[model samples]
Target: MKFALSLLVGAAAAQCGKRSPSYLTWTADSFIEHGVEKNFHYTQATLYLGYEAAYELTGDEKYAEWYRNQIDDAVVLEDGTIKDWDYEFYSLDDYRIGNNFLWWYERTGEEKYRKAADIIREQINRHPRNQAGGFWHRRPVYPNQMWLDGIFMADTFYAKWTKMFDNDNTTAWDDILKQFVLIDSHTRNHTTGLLAHGYDESKTAVWADPVTVNRDSGSAPLVWDRAVGWYFIALLEAIQLFPESHEGHSILVGFYKDLAAALKKAQHKSGGWWLIMSEPYPGMEGNYIESSASAMFTYGWLKGIKLGLISKGEYYKAAKKGYKLLTNRFVRADDECLLNWEGTVEVGSLCCNGTYEYYISIPLQTNDYKGVGPFMLASYEWETY
Candidate 1:
C-alpha cells in the first residue's frame, strides 16, 4: 500500500510541471498591482490560500513570495499591528484571511503574523451564536442565521488556533464540533441528502419556510452549490488539522464521508455540479454547471481521497472527470499565456425571500476570484494526486 501511494505521489509531482507558472504569476501580479484596496478583501484572501498550496506543490519560491507579500500588504503595519481588520462587525467572512496569517506565521516565525491572527481569534471569541450554539453568519442584521459559508470562514481557523496555541483546551474542539452538528441538523434535506444554503433559527427570514415540518423547514429555499462547496472543503480542512486521537476527529471524518457520498450522487452528467446542485437535470431553466463550486467539490474529493478519509476508485473517477471538465469547459488561455476561468456566478446570497430566478439571474463572470481561487486549489490537488 505504501509503495502504491508513493508511486501515485511521484506521478502527480511529475504532472505538476505541466501547469503554467506564467498563468499563476500573471494572476497574482494582476491582483497585487491593483493595490491593496482590491486585494485586502476576503475573496482575494481565498486566492492567496491557493497560491500558498501551489508554492508547496511546485517547489516554487515565487508562489510562496506572492502569498507572503499579499498577506503582508493586507495586515502588516508600521507599528507592528495588523491594520484594516474589523473585529467589531463580528462577521465570519472577516476571519477567512486569517488563515493566511496563520500560515505565514508558521512559515517565517514572524510575530506580526501571530499578532494579526490574534485579532481574528479575538473576534471569534466574541461572535454571536444562535440558541443551538451555531455561530451566526454575521451580527445585528443577520441575527440567528447560519450560512453554510461561515463554517469555512471561521471553524478551520478556530480549529488550527486551538491546535497551535491551546493544545490543552478541549472545549474549543467541542465548540467547533457543535457548529457542524447544529448546521447539519438544521440545514439537511433528508430526501436529497444535501444541505441548504442557510438556516434561520428564528424562522423569520422570508426565504425560510416557517410552517413546514419537513427536514428543510426553516432553511433557505434552495440547495445552493457554492455554499455547500464551502462546507465540504471546510470539513476536509478541519480533519487535516484535528489531532487523530481527539474525539472529534472521527466525527469530522464521518461528516465528510456523508457529504462526499451525497455530492457524488448529485454530480451532473457533464462532470460538473449545477448552480443549484439539486437541479442537475436538463431543461431546468436557469440551471447551469457553475465553475467555482465544481472546482471546490473537486478539490474536496481529491484532498479527501489523498488523506485516506475517502475510498478510492469512484471518488477518484469523479474528481478526474470534474477536473477535465473544468479544463475543457471553463479554462481558456490568453495570448500571453495567462489562464482565464469562466462560468462563475459573480455572487449569490439569500436576501429575504429570494427565488430560484434570483439565483439563476445573477451575473456570470470570467476570472472572478471565487472561481479562480478554487480552480487553482483544485489544479494543485489534481497535480498532487
Candidate 2:
C-alpha cells in the first residue's frame, strides 16, 4: 500500500475533517506504528525485514533503495568500527535490522553493508548488562530493564552477525541465550501462557510488580496486540539463527507451540482475536477483535508452519481463518486513490486496570505501519493461500 503522506481538505472539511478523510503519510519518524504520533525512535531495523522481503518479492529496486537508506543511516566512517548511530539514543531494540543489512551486504558485497553491520557489533561490544550479564534494553537510560520487544530486535541481529563478522564470536550466542533466560525468568506467565510487555530490573517504574519482580507495562492483560505481535515475529526470527543442537532450541520450540495453543483459545469467534484476550464476552465493551495484532499473529503463524515449527493440520486452519477475516474485515478500498489502507491497532485498550471497557477502546485507523508492513510480508509469504 502506498503510504499517504499528505491530504487535501477544504476549509469546511478541515473544520470537520473527522467527518472527512483523515490520513497519514510516509514519514521518517518511528512512531507511526498504529498511525499514531509517538515519541519512539524510528529504527531502520523494523523496516529492514519488510524491505528485504519486499525487494525479493517485487524484484523492485525501490525496496533495495529503502534498504540502502537504512544502511546510510547507520554507516559511519571508512571503517565501520564506529557508527553515526548513538547507542545512547536507543539500544539494540531494532537490531534485527542488521541481519537485513548483512544479507544485503552478502548479496552485493557492498563494503558499507559489511561495515555497517560491524558498527552494530561495536554497539553490542559496549552494551550495558544486568547482574546476570543480560544486555539492558537500551543504553544510558532504562538500565537493567529488559523489554520483550528488545529480544527480537537484538537477538536476531546478533545471531546472524555471529555467522558473519566473526563466527568465532561465541560471546554473541552466550548473550543471545542469556537474554532469553532473563526475559523468560521474569516475564513468562506460566498459567496464562503469554508474556508481559516489558520487564524492569530496577523496579523503578510504577508498573513494576513489587513482589514477583515483573512489571505491569502492558496496559491490558488482554494481550496488547502490537506488543505481542512484535514478540511473535522476534521468536521466529531468532529461531532461524539457532542450531537444532542448541540447548534452548527444543525449549524455545515448545515455547512457541504452547503460546500458539493459548492464543488459539483467545481468537475471536469471527476469526480475529478479541481486544482483551482470554475473555471476549458477548455484548461486552472491550472484548472485541483487533486488526494489527490479529494480522501480526496471522503472519507469524503462517511463517511458523513454513518453517516446520508447528503442526500444519490445526495451526494452518487457524491461520487460514485469520487471513480471511483480516482481509475481509480490516481491508477497505479507496476509489479516490488518495487513501488505500487501514488497520485497527487493537480492538481494546486498558489503563487504570484491565476491563472490557479498556479492551475495546483502542483507536483504529488505515495504513498503520504496524499492520501494513506485516500485511505486506504476510501476503507475500502465502500468495497462493
How high is the lDDT of residue 174 in model 1? 88
Query: Which lDDT tens digits does candidate 1 get at residues 142-177?
Result: 889988899999999998888899967878888988
- Put down candidate 2 lDDT per residue, 227-337, tens digits, no spaces: 667777877776777666666667667767777776776676667765445433533643446666787788888888888888788788888888767655655434323
TM-score of each: 0.89, 0.76
Superposed model 2: Cα runs more than 4 Å off = 1-44, 65-84, 94-96, 139-141, 210-222, 278-284, 336-339, 344-365
Worst 10 residues of 1 by lDDT: 1-10
Clashes of each: 0, 14
